[model samples]
Target: MVGQRQFDERRTLDRAREVFWLKGYGATSMQDLASASGVLRGSLYNAYRDKETLFLRVFDDYAEQFLADAAQALAQPVVDQALRAFFDFTITSMTTGVPTRGCLTTKTAIDTKADGERIRAALRDLLDKMERLVHERLSTGEARSRLAIPPAEAARVLITMTRGIVVMERVYQDPERLRATAAALIDALLTPVDPGRRSQTG
Candidate 1:
């Protein structure tokens, strides 16, 4: 019985996550959550206590999955391959599956106010992890003479560019344009330091 309850809870959370993703937290009501998750309001309240608690739980699940995907991208043998994996994931998130859903982290960050300090902090930590992953990749790339700029700087720029791209996706929603931008950004970042070095050789 306990196992079945747990499974049902997760299934409901999955549905809730989708609802929250599609509609921001401020806009999602208890009734909406109940309808979307196909779980009774009484059960949801009994399980999660309130809307804020359930939203946080759903956010936790989203963050965990997002970081796990990042870990996979970072696990690639080559830095360029790792970066490509990261960009691919970002592009897919912005354009495919869930349309017009720029990013949960971004949406939450933009929508939340002083009351959402905890959520903001959690989002910052996740972004830091992403930046660190890029930094680590660039550190390795630097050793191979693949980068002209400092690893830290490159990572910062990449993170900034990625965030910008994510925002732009909400307005533009053009996959090819975003892909071109990503390709250009990668090319610029991977360019070698030496004047004589025309390509990424190593």
Candidate 2:
């Protein structure tokens, strides 16, 4: 059985995560956290010491779980299929829920500042991991002559495009359009060189 302290901490952390995810780091206040966490303000301070520190804890937990799930989903052997799944997951995860809070990293990229360097660094690390996984997937595609661009270049393009897509979805609130955009991106990345153009150039 979970000890009371451990259980209380977990509950507080999860509540804080939800509040931050929905409202963002800068906007979430101490009272907001205390209310959402169902802990008294005094007890909240005693447990977490301060709001920013509690936020960091919540952000770290969210990032860890998000990356783990993403890594598994992007691990499909086929590059095209894996990318399609990635886009689908990204869209659904960001758009389907109420309030439509986008990816936490994507939100932080827009909302955070120098004061939140820890969160920013963690997000950068996650993006780097994403790029590495995409590079590997593209490398496999390149081996089969399904990709013309260098895997490294394509990986960078894909990760950047994904970030853009996530941001755009928040403003547009159109899932179909975002899905199409992601699909086009994958198609462009995987499109082979035209044989006629190659022949003429050769």
Candidate 3:
């Protein structure tokens, strides 16, 4: 019954995201969004038309923030450090929330209906954006032994491993093990120029 200006749109959308993230797109209902968002069901429908459309809005919001975080992680001075920061961010983000907490794009990609083309397209766009971010970082002239692979290929490998780590975090729920694996992956992939000593992030 509240007026549009009276309602907190961002707050409502954030709550809506929580519901979708927890219950998933298939299982969640508009009423669920209303309850979680503290907005009337009618108001929500009026604004977003349908759950698919509403989810698109919420997912886009999430993607913006997610990409911003990834960009920050990849902003470290050293390439290896930047890569480690990215993995650390991923591990902390995926593992901190409740048991069902995982990558939203990843979870949605797996769970959304086959006919959900719009959602699928959004997911693909987000993945491509992430790969581009990594590629930009990898293309930088950070010193010390870097990957033999091309920046584009290395970015793909990093993104693929990141998704795999998301799956691992969901299944294993072991943080230390995941960190160790990240370290090993980094060691295997990034070689030190000096060989004897490693270059630290500045």
The most accurate candidate by lDDT is: 3
Quantify how close model 3 is to the true structure by its C-alpha RMSD in Å.
2.9
Candidate 3's C-alpha runs over 4 A off are 1-6, 143-145, 195-202
**2 or 3, greater by TM-score:** 3
lDDT of 1: 0.78
How does candidate 3 score on lDDT?
0.83
The TM-score between candidate 2 and the true structure equals: 0.84
lDDT of 3 at 66: 91
Model 2 spans > 4 angstroms off: 1-7, 112-114, 141-144, 192-202
Residue 48 error for model 2, in Å? 2.5
Backbone collision count in every prediction?
0, 0, 0
For residues 1-202, what per-residue lDDT tens digits would candidate 3 score against the true structure? 5435457889988999888887788888999999998889988888889999999999999999999999999999888889889889888877767664777777787884624889889989999999999999988776234777778888898888888887888788897788888878777777666634444532
Q: Give all TM-scores, in the order shown.
A: 0.85, 0.84, 0.89
Off by over 4 Å in 1: 1-7, 112-115, 141-144, 192-202
